[model samples]
Target: MAYPYDSLLPQVTRPRTISPLPPSAPGEEAKDEEVEQVKWKRPAVVTPQAVHSKRALLEKEQEQTASSEMPRPSQGELFPAREQEEQHRQQVEEPEENGQNIKAEPQAELPEAQSDIMALKRKNKDDMRRVQEENLNQQRGDQQNQVSERVAATPLMKHPLPSCLLTNKDHVQAELQDSEASNKVREKRLEEEIKIIRDKANRLSQSLQKQVAIKKINLQGLQRKQLTVNEIMIMKRNRSPSVVNYLDSYLLGEELWLVLEYMDGGALSDVISETFLSEEQMAAISRECLRGLDFLHSNHIIHRDVKSDNILLRTDGSVKLADFGLSTQLTPEQNRRCTLAGTPWWMAPEVVTGQPYGPKVDIWSFGIVGIEMVEREPPYCNQSPASAQRLIATVGTPKLRHPKLLSALLRDFLSCCLQKDEEERWSAMELLQHPFVTSAKPASILSQLINSVKKRKKN
Candidate 1:
């Protein structure tokens, strides 16, 4: 406690040091004199960039070695001076400030000028290879997309229920059972709707003094499948109320499907055959047909076949001119069709005589149909179809079976329609203004005829 102040002051302490063990193996090694002498080798100090460059150089050397047997790169192929001596001379003759270069030494060189060309060749080869790989990947992607689209487009069989009622039934019975079970609710709903429609029609007739045609609706699902391209085109013609409506078109399986308006009144020929129509009724029918023909002619279409068979009627008193299978379209400048394409009996004298006819030919056919309305048959229905054609070609004009039954004005209209000179034939628009066509209201007249025919058919 009584030590000097200097000794008691805080002092800095040094760290304790431990020495390593000394080596003594040299002495034993010296005793073994037969051991080979070893030299002290220094390790190379390599950076990350140097290692990468070394790898690239090795790859280049491997490529050059391979190129001796395989195809060389485009750049290397152009320069053939790849000899070792030339390389050495190029290395020794450095670019000195002189007119000519002399070799300073005999050693191969890594010329910086050639370095750019080598780098460019290597880069181009790599880019070309990468581009080819990308193209291959794109092609693979395209093929996969096409396959997926095809699979998505194809329809597979889908059973409705999880459990099956395999109660020892045949194939037909099984199908019937399955169909009934699936559509039972839908069928009941449709039956109720149909009942409502009939009741509404009856109620409207009683209360509002309006009659509606209540035909049974055919409720099969329409599919756009199995229709030919030509049928589709015909169905999708330019629409007028006189023309049938095309609702939709689609593709199913290997076919095209078309949905069209249901024309239930049957063919015009059936109506004519089933009932004897009055003159006013005949005039009304001719009026509506002329209207349709006028519309078609105005649009530059030739209804080559114009007969009762091609006309259609709706339950609610609408007339539509149907069946354009043989119809031809004329250009804005053209006015004639040279082909003879009408039905043998309905063909015009001009058409039968193998003359170039225009929309006027349709006028002749309409005249025959007018005659059909009065006679209950075409002009030469008793004759063979061949004979009918020959008669049409040679005969002056078809005579109505009962000319006394037709009024003088009506007879004159038919005469205008059946004119031998197409220049003299009454055009559809002009025929629409005829005194015969003006005698009746089309909707009421035709509707009466249709209702009577329906009653006759039912009886």
Candidate 2:
């Protein structure tokens, strides 16, 4: 089959150099018409140098291949893009000059393929730049994340205090804690102290209550020991009117305590008025009464209420004065009697006259008591207390009846007992030696009375 022109094989035309028209005879015109005709082909001329360069490169490749164990290069590998650019430029310039026919598709194909290489290089560079940028950004992000993590994990740091300020602050805190602890300890100790005080107060209150109870019991016991008035009056009714004896007494306590010796014999006025007393009875009662008074006076005690009701008779008929409730001791001046006290009938003239009386008044009252005993009634018994006081003021002294019936010794004793003057009164000891009470009978009588009282209670 015949190939179409479009698909025909390419034919290259080359120009050969004719021997330079022999330079015949210097002026012979260069053959204008007959000289050797030279044929020029654009492709041949244009490609020849390239072909030689390719041949040299191929030789180098061959040499490299022969010497090395490496494989031979491909046609494209042997001629680098730059060398290919120079070859294309040579080919293009020749074609343009010679108006040669060229395969447009191959030339265009070459430029396009080269542009692809440039594009690939640019793309690769862009990819590399992008990758590097991504790496940088990734690093930045990682750095930012790390910074965020650190910021989140760690607390912000504060500025440091000065060393002195720090030390002072620590010291102050320690002192404050110490003070609080000390206060707590003090509070605890105070609680203990309060508890102790409360316990003491309770115990003291209990002790005081116990003491009051004991005192109350003791006082009740003491009050219950005495006899009742009704029982005493009954006993007095049974006894003889003139008898005064300890046998009529009552025992008052569990241990036979507080014996009340009887203080009766009717009244002294009754005893005297019934009869003029025998000398023996007069001497006995009078001397004993005086002795009792002297004993009281020596003790510095004043019997302010000495009277017939207070004069007691023993069972054997001896006399003893009693009831010293209103008595006073002159030893203490404040104890001096200020109140008027005594039987009006037997009151001393000084007492009746409203004079301040001391123990000496006892002597004057004793004389009056003596006068009543001898006569058996007070000298002013018929008069009222006021009239008797007036009588004492008007009369100098009292007189006793039956003065002649009385023995001289008894008379003198009675006179001595009735002496109106206090200084003239005999002391109880002086009267003890007087002929009246010197007999052993009164002493015997006292002993017998105490024994009788003791025996009566036992029986």
Candidate 3:
């Protein structure tokens, strides 16, 4: 029988890992779409000329969808029937327009097909990227073919950079622009610029070249050296997850393969689907995430990207925060990191604004994840990543609005996690003591959500 968690939890790479990163899933895992052996279809690249054509096709589809789709009875009127229709319309036609297969039959419940929705959406984005890459390759190919033709026909000009052409007291500015047309040592455009500069340099004399050269005494002394994470980073302490087991790592030519334990439980995002988590349920998940955040913060590591997707679960009610691609290992001297990393929807404000941030950024992300647990998606889930970042940076912390609907204590808890001032924001240590977290049931409470998913999958 097909299992629910089985489809969700991806198989992982178990190689002896060379880097200090945790055990990881293999990079080349084929997506769910390709698993069905469907022939990959390539659509014409989206270009400005085709904009009207694409728009008219979309409008025709929307008109047809509206007429055929009957509105289902609103489920308690909390969410509208139109919302479902819009989602359904998008799901059905989005892939077809973007060059992927439409989903089969509708399921009785969202849980049955929820996993595929994300997979298809992700696939659509990947297809667009592929189209762009192909266009880039074709452009580069054409440029390569014309390199010699351009070199013969076009006269050499001064370097494009203004610094190179300035009339300031620089002596090199007096010489004629270099006219070496055959040379292509730099980038295609840059090589042309360099040849122009070189032609000017040749006229100055061999004496100028002699003055510029600082001959090396010995080339034999230079040798390559070994590299390690510790050499580049000042890691205060190293931490590992109890669930994500590290196996082995070895070098395969240019790439290093790391083996990590496979998580059978998939992600917490999967748990959020098809089920509305209660306050108690949110507390349990939040507490576990906070515990992990605390561990990282204490060790002077910042898990810059903290979101539901990055959190992995196991069958035994254990949850581990995964995906350390954006994680930073700060030394004792470093107070904050200025890198604008992490998912835009869940990003802290300071991070979006390019402001230096400390461990508290993770706390902000943790808060957003808590909100995510309540509403299957994070805040601004509907917005594009660029728009989300713009809105978040301009607006102060996002308010849940309609707060009276949720409990007062829970509202206060959100308030604590989402403080605009990083200095004022409650640390994970402090949030652990809140009544919401304090009264939260043990990690065992999560098993209820997991088991329900499994049962539904089994059905």
Candidate 4:
């Protein structure tokens, strides 16, 4: 039978209830009329609680059906829904808390991080500034050191002491004044010492000059005094009043020193050069020279170089024959000397021609000395030595430059001395007896001429 509100209610699927018919007769067909009828259930009343309960019951029944249909999970594999829900909630809540903490932590530490960055920047700036300052200090120190070294190396006069030693101005000024005063004193002392030294040096130079002049005079004297051993022996052997006296002889090292009589009037050549000789003066000189020659010839010693230069005079007018360096002894075995020697102007023709000659060669030179007295120089005085030799060799007799000025007696005497042939030439003994020599005044009168020459030289 159907209910009245069944159409208004939701349809619910339910199992049908049917009463079984009496066991059907074996092999007998069941008739419709014999079957139990299906009973219709009545609809339940609808309420909020009932509806909720029914939905719950339906969900529960669906779960039971699904549970029954699927295989059951093991206990270890099973997770409770409540526990999963709690875990999910905790995960979500933890993320939210961590996100908040992350945001809050950054916000809270922002100022401190900024402060730390500022501190690091400050430290970097401080370090850079310190390094720059150190570099600047080093540069300043180097510059100061360079300046100090320069000051030290420079001269004291160039770089004076700094006056700014004291902070007080007055003190610095006083100290500078004192230093300047001391420097002035020192400079003055040094200048005085220098002046003294200069004066001493000047005196020393003058003394040295005087010593040199004396040495030069001695050297000239020594030059005239130089004598060979043969000459010295000859001199020692023949010490006549007319010949220069050799007082002593000494050998000093390689040089031979002879102390001879000093002739204050100097050589006859000096007198001839200074003044014109009168015939009488010439005669006197000739007589003295002839005497010396005669003495030398008698001793068998030939005075080869017989010139006015070899004739020296004293202040007392004592004439003597000097400089016997060329004198040679004539032995009886070799009575003639063939050596070509003697001054070219006065050289004999035979001597010039390399012919054997004797003491007559001295007479020829004495004749030339006489010519020197008359003419102030011999014939060919202007010619060179070679040219003079050539003229002497070629010319028979040398002509006097002023023949007219000479007396006949003087000319005759000169001709006798200057003969071309050595054999024809008058001997020194014969010449000493000639009127020209015999007529000569005393040798004491020659001092007047010497004094006059000295006066002229002084003027």
Model 3 spans > 4 angstroms off:
1-237, 240-245, 455-459
Can you write out model 3's per-residue Cα lDDT over 1-459, one digit (the tens) per residue? Answer: 233233333452211223455544555233433322322222122233345566589779777876889864444366686667544433333234366544444434443244555566576556656667887999999998799788887877744547744645354544423323323333475546445544443433243332111111111222211222331132223446522433333332233333344566677787777678889878888888888888878877788888888787766677877655467778778878997777889888898889989999999898888788766677788899999999888886887745777888888898899998999999989998999899988887677677777677667
**Ordering by lDDT:** 4, 1, 3, 2
The number of the candidate with the highest lDDT is 4
Estimate, for each residue in 1-459, the C-alpha lDDT of model 4 and write its tens digit: 243434433454323445666777655532332121101211122234534565588678768877778766633258676555443322222122332421211222223323555556566556666667887999999999999999989886776456764357778788999999998997797667556644554565465442110011122355445436676788888899898866545443344555565577778888989989899988888898899999989989998998889898877788999878888899999999898778888898888888888888899999899888998888898899899888899986898877887899999999999899877899999998899999999998899998777677678
Deviation (Å) of 2 in candidate 2:
99
TM-score of each model, paired residue for residue: 0.49, 0.38, 0.48, 0.51
The segments of candidate 2 whose C-alpha lies over 4 angstroms from its true place after superposition are 1-259, 262-276, 332-338, 443-459
Q: Report, for every candidate in turn, its global Cα lDDT versus the true structure.
A: 0.69, 0.56, 0.65, 0.73
What TM-score does candidate 1 reach? 0.49
Q: What ranges in model 1 sit over 4 Å off?
A: 1-231, 234-237, 250-257
Mark the regions of model 4 whose C-alpha exceeds 4 Å error after superposition: 1-227
- Candidate whose TM-score is highest: 4
Return the TM-score for candidate 4, rounded to 2 decimals: 0.51
Deviation (Å) of 57 in candidate 3: 94
Positional deviation of residue 390's Cα in model 1 after best superposition, in angstroms: 1.3
Distance (Å) between predicted and true CA of 279, model 3? 1.2
Task: Estimate candidate 3's alpha-carbon lDDT, on a 0 to 1 scale.
Answer: 0.65
